[model samples]
Target: MAKTIFITGASRGFGKLWAAAFLEKGHKVVATARDLRSLDDLVNKYGTNILPLQLDVNDRAADFAAIAQAKQHFGSIDVLINNAGYGLFGSIEETTEQQAREQMETNFFGLLWLTQAVLPVMRAQGHGHIIQLSSVLGLVTVPILGLYNASKFAVEGLSESLAQEVKAFGINVTLVEPNQFATDWGSASAAVTTPMPEYDGARAWLQAAASEDKIGIPEATVPAILQLIDSENPPLRLLLGKQGHPWTRQVYEGRFAEWDAWQEIAAAAHGK
Candidate 1:
């Protein structure tokens, strides 16, 4: 069962880890990154089993072309891992228009273009699996990470609709929602906005949460991802990390409580 896996953002983080894992498992991987040189080690080790491509996920044209190239190279793509995105650190009031746009462009639009490009190929083959790399923040919002939360929320909603639309086509869609990890995602790799004194108190929770104890090991996610990809019937959403469950449950419970509290208002508004 050596399937071809087309992975975006393969230079580092989960992308790099998963690409190497899949290669070690004898699966052909089309590894893409902004800089192909970043993937040199994977190529050097895995040889022809890995096709390292230079890709800026924001480019729609490049996404389609990359999909075509991968299909032509492997003859079939059994899975797609959209692991390409970065965190944007800023309070909602401090976020700029450019910051919001760029965040959406890379996280949401980029994944959309690639998914659109791969649809036809998967349809023809009659089966495929698409794994979206969302965040636990996608389920519950946190201060200082507003824009990143928005992008992942968009991903969650898009994937929900997509799963229903593609079920008849035998395509499986899964949203992998992971909590904070020990990575450069929110540090060196993130885009930080100028901090404002007004939000300093609001941002304290984030600063306090930034420690080794709060983050999971990036490599620990490999087995969870492998099980997800290898399953015949994968779940629509998979939450990773010990922190994800409690946070998500609390958010959901609060939402239900609010909904129940507002039921009367909702009914009154619906009255004809």
Candidate 2:
């Protein structure tokens, strides 16, 4: 059963691969990028099924226009994937306020605006899936990447709440958490200045830990994403790489365990 799909940031990275995978599966894909020229190869290959459109998710009017065009082109969008985001790495003190807000604007608010734009269309059709491209960083906070982590963390919270809100309307929300995957995201991460000369040693360690070269097979995520789209019951959170599984579980488990341990004390303090 081929369905119409609309994806942002389809010029490259996971968005590009996902667009290709859907096209290969005989689905109609409205692939969008900030520059339509970057998607020329995909346009040439898929021709009719792949409609490359110019879209900058941060632009509210432009994003709405893109969504309208997709609906008009494919009748209705069965799947909407919000993958237009970038990584901005820096410590809280080292990064400027403007830089921090910009990160949230692109990674968090941009996704929100797009989701809002597509919701009515999905609800009108009676069913649709919305996929949000998040990062393992969203689950855990690491050194130096505070800004990037904060942005993704916001998405994690947004998706969790949005999932419940739209569940009644037959709309599903999925969050994609990739370990490292060979993408240009690492190179695009914001460069932060080291305020303290003494922290030089720590900064180097953070850089190595966050390197993109350590991750493998960026294409692996696309299969899981597609599987969720096709499944009758898909998980709200989709962890991409095997390397991230244990760590991600541990983070949540550890936090829950600690919270449980403090429950009695918390209740007593609140006069419960």
User: How many steric clashes between backbone atoms does each model show?
Assistant: 0, 0
Which candidate has the highest lDDT of all? 1
Q: lDDT for every model? A: 0.94, 0.85
lDDT of 1 by residue, 168-232 (tens): 99999999999989878977779988999999987887888766787999999999988888999
TM-score of each prediction: 0.98, 0.93
Pairs of residues clashing in candidate 1:
none
Task: Write model 2 residue lDDT over 112-211, tens digit each, in one string.
Answer: 9889999999999999999999988899877877888988999999999999999988999999888877778777533454466666666788877756
Clashes of 2: 0
User: How far does residue 263 in candidate 1 sit from its true spot (Å)?
Assistant: 0.9
Clashes of 1: 0
Model 2 residue 187 CA deviation (Å) reads 0.7
What candidate 2 gets wrong by more than 4 Å, as runs, is 188-198, 211-214
Of candidate 2, the 10-residue stretch with the lowest lDDT total is 188-197
